[model samples]
Target: MSQETLSIAGFNVSPHHYIGGQRVASGELFDLHCPIDQSLLGRISEGTPAHVDAAILAAQAAYPAWSALTAAERKPYLDRFAAEIGKRADAFCQLESNDAGILLSRMKHGVIPRAMLNITWFAEHALSLQDRPLETEQATHIVRHDPAGVVVIITPWNSPLMLATWKLGPALAAGNTVIIKPPEWAPLTSSLLADCAHAAGLPAGVLNIVQGSGAGTGARLVSDPRLARISFTGSVPTAKWIAQAAGANLVPCSLELGGKSPFIVLEDADIDNAAATGALMYRNAGQVCLAGTRFLVHSDIRDHFVAAMRAYVEKLNIGDPRDIAVEIGPIIHPRQVERVKGFVERALADGAELLWGGKPHPFGAQYFEPTMLTNLRQDSEIVQNEVFGPVLTLQTFDSDAQAIAMANGTDYGLGGVCYGETAHATAIAEQVRTGFIWVNSFGIRDLAAPFGGIKRSGIGREGGDWSFEFFCDVKDVVLPKKPFRASFSHR
Candidate 1:
């Protein structure tokens, strides 16, 4: 293997499509650079429509046998896949960190483990699933979930492996083969995922990887009629395109798109803890879709909360992601650095006050300071749009109703936070338009809980039984009573 190649599980990680358990290095290759320093990482095989067709063919061929297996029978394969991922956790972490400019420590601690847990949980949970049996006056009804056919999963650059496996686990557990189109910006870990699957002896064509631009590769993937469903996590604009394509084929889609989530702090909230939790939103340089970038605080305690948050934001050790001690790292890419700068410039132009860091960090072209904006109007571009950078907005509300209104004002309703005494926070949380809300806590997740958003955020949910339903086609069967009496319908 060359220096560009990463060998995991005796397989050299190539920047090429893995179709039917073989490395298909066809087509012209595109260069992948490390986000941390813009160094050549690998030359990815540019996926073509032909590549997509091949993947579809492979999935079609594998679906029959894979779906025929019972949940109990399939668990061993998924278990082994998780074991393989565990064996190469270090590589997964390092690759993801280098590829995304996220802290290696963060990936080591959170993302990779969650990816493995995703597989583990779905594998075990699938075995315990029971169809609901209902007794009616004249008949008995049974609702069963049957596997949909081959599905396509389009993932985002930020937390690619975790997000992909989040959908992949249930999609596989529900007995659907998959074609994953990892973002070209960070395609390394996904290729490694295919390697892990292969190492686990997952049958050929059961899982495939395609890499390339969204305009061609992604567009072709979601539009394909052969896919039973399309699951995507990315920007809202791209989701609209995916929806249009999926709609043309009438293929169902599960979209987890962008967010402008809010974190509210009432006067009665624990200011220090609230600030700490709010500061955590800047993780991964604010690349998270569920990040609560909009902070709303009670006017009575606004000044105090701002000071607390400013102090906490300063404590973050922004440096190279390779350094384990660094808290915040560079923006995912130079383009994103400019995006944050544009937002900061426009925010200041819109008369917003810069309470804390806003300039590019000294480390390199990609590094950015964690920025916080105060005195921002609700109509500001920085307030409504998804910055996808280490920038945040701070606003003050007079009443609970005002807070809820301001929080719900954005086009997104993904995830939100309400910080206050338990009862008040719960009350406020209930009024926000988001799909999920936490009272006093941020980033706390329950494995079985459903996660998605409303409005422009996204459609459909994923997790637990929700994932089962989304990944499988549920049908109801009606059985007549033993007497087999026919009854006339009355209207």
Candidate 2:
């Protein structure tokens, strides 16, 4: 491939499946295009069930040596890997921004740096894993943590590297050999990750990358009995299928699915701050799982909140992602743009008032304007479903109780935000059903805290000690109080 046709992080790129520390080619190929201009990015191998089997067999073969190493022995490799990523951070960010249609500014300043921090944080945290001892009068019990044999991590295209590292950092630190299946839409950076692993001197088969569509490669990997566990981040419908397949094999799986999270603005909230944070609905074109897509403002200040939010979104620059000044960029693909437009069109037909920017941008093929809608019914499809685009739905709540009820009404319980006075926000946050809540702010994440959701959003946590535990199994050893004596005379 020529540099103009297939370039990633300033390097001419050709995609291949990474297995047993070697880049392997397949008979079939799939083209990946840049969403910004629909330009040809590169071609990736279309992995088959046979490829999945090979990746699994490679991971299984590497498990013994990889797992036998103590955390102290493993930390150096992880540290080196983090350093390698740091060296190429700028290039990686640009590649990701172009490949995923995220703004270059956000990718360079926010996502890429955070991904590096994730690797470093988990590398050091691995050393803190210590056995626990429970002492009792009759017996003493000792608990040990052991790595699962082979783990499969499947990540979505929205935030491919960040989400993949969220699982990979801890999974590798816990000493499990892994197979990473990046979504077909954005798999470029993941291939770069495999390169970094090799440069860090990781053993063969310790980390593998398999590139293919979800239905073909994803299903095969999930159903494989050799897989010790699976960590997946994607749509709820796909998560359900993965859960069923993993369940049949009696393997544990961690799912981080979709969200239609609520952003509640109280009557006494600081209008400026609330509006600023609420504008996060347009961040990454609102494709984030934690994006607060539903707005439930107190009726007394609903008008003020709507006006402020509109002003904030109107000032946002929407154009080519490569432009550093652009705040909102293209959707991941043309199909996704159509899906977002469908949601807006249905809301208009259902009698919701469109405040601003509800149609496709005339400047680009895959661009949807930042959209705002008000007076939407609480049970309406647009209000209840995840648009996964730069779209926001506005509604009003009569009281604090009503706000809490509306916040917890959705099937999702991933993330939420409450804006008001400190004590008032705290009270409302306590009643919210989501796994994580932000008070007076949004998108502030601490790597040390556990992150996951209840209800249908997800099943298992994915940060701090929770991530370490997810890739490991616990074993208990009990000791008798005293030595036993021979009792042959009793017979």
Candidate 3:
């Protein structure tokens, strides 16, 4: 059965079903846990080595038929796929918000539209595939783009539906069959997506969903010899493990990993704008890999930025994610809350002053107030490590060189921001070692441009064209039979 055909409750009715030649959910079991309340969502059939073998077999069996379909034929499937998603869009959003502990407003207003746009972007790009022209001096030259066989997309829980679409959209647009492995913490949205795909009349084996832990199922998907490509988004440590496994199998993999990005406020930057933009660091409870976790301010304007930032953090409404005005929700889980607390405690121990919202929320239970810590030492853990929560650390720089140094000192370079006028911020953004940089904003992204981290942030690009390119192989054919070629050697 396809993910699209799954039950509304989010469990695969027959996780052990066979597609093409592969078997899924034979003897494996995976429990989906709600990150919001730590309740059990449901259990999916666990994927084992034998199951992985079957999936590879199924993908290989279906590849030729799926690939042979013309772009026009594939176009309808995409339209139907999107329609299916639209059918249960509300259910999907609710599940995603619940699973990620993100506000429903953000999910409905931000994530869903982006997910739909991703699909539309891929569909539009699919029709414009023009082959490269050969030089007149050559008798014959051809450049063809072909799909990589048997792709595996391993997605994280943070933005389950949206992130999965990022990988799925381009992979399918480029005509690759994919097996998606949803994160253990949030499989509900994926299950709904799978259902949509099936209802859209996509071929049974064209898309599959396998649920399990990163250790077993993730390893199996990465190590399987039949997979030609793997696209993964998660922590750096997990990306490392995936890279190693993919290396052993000699398969190409694309990774979107961790980040400890910085936001630099120049001496000329408007303090109010910088402070307001810095608040985005706490978006999604600061769980985003590209969140601007570090603040590098000009010593001249540092105190003003800190004071305004403290006031903003204090004013945030912290409560249930379902509440409309709740600016800050509970973290994905209590464990994440504890992790953020540990970071705060460590920062205080290292002599950082709590500027605002240091303690847990007065309402209690998995919610932490939006927090800002000033007087943070340059080398303190709060400024160094990624504290993926509603916490921002303050640091001041005497010179532009010091700002650059502090920003680049971390292992991450996923994102950076410079707050100033157009020309100056653009120049500074150019110097930051990051895949994405904004002049006055922090986390804005467009589907047209490629998005990925530099350094430890990630290893590959994701977007419409960039993602399609990642899933394709280029083959060049040259013929030297033309009259203009004196040396007829074909390289």
| Model 2: worst 10 consecutive residues (lDDT sum) | 1-10
Give the TM-score (vs. native) of candidate 3: 0.91
lDDT of 3 by residue, 3-122 (tens): 323343343333333444234444556555555556665556766776666666766777888878765678788877887777676777667766667787888788777777777678
Candidate 2 structure quality by residue, lDDT tens digits, 1-491: 21223566576444888899988888888888999889887778878887888999999999999999998899899888888888777767777887898788887888778888888888788887756787988778887677988999999989998888888998998899999999899988888888889899999999999999999988999999999999999999999999999999999999999799989999889998999888777978889989888888999998888889888988888888878998888899888988999999999999999988898887689888888898788889999888899889888999999999999998999999999999999999999999999999888888899899989899999888889789988778888788867687854
Candidate 1 error regions (>4 Å)? 1-12, 485-491
Worst 10 residues of 1 by lDDT: 1-10
What TM-score against the true fold does each predicted structure earn? 0.96, 0.96, 0.91
At residue 57, what lDDT does model 3 achieve?
72
Against the hidden true structure, what lDDT does model 2 obtain?
0.88
lDDT ranking of the models: 1, 2, 3
- Judged by TM-score, which candidate is best? 1
lDDT of 3: 0.76
CA lDDT of every candidate = 0.88, 0.88, 0.76
* Clash pairs detected, candidate 2: none
Clashes of each: 0, 0, 7
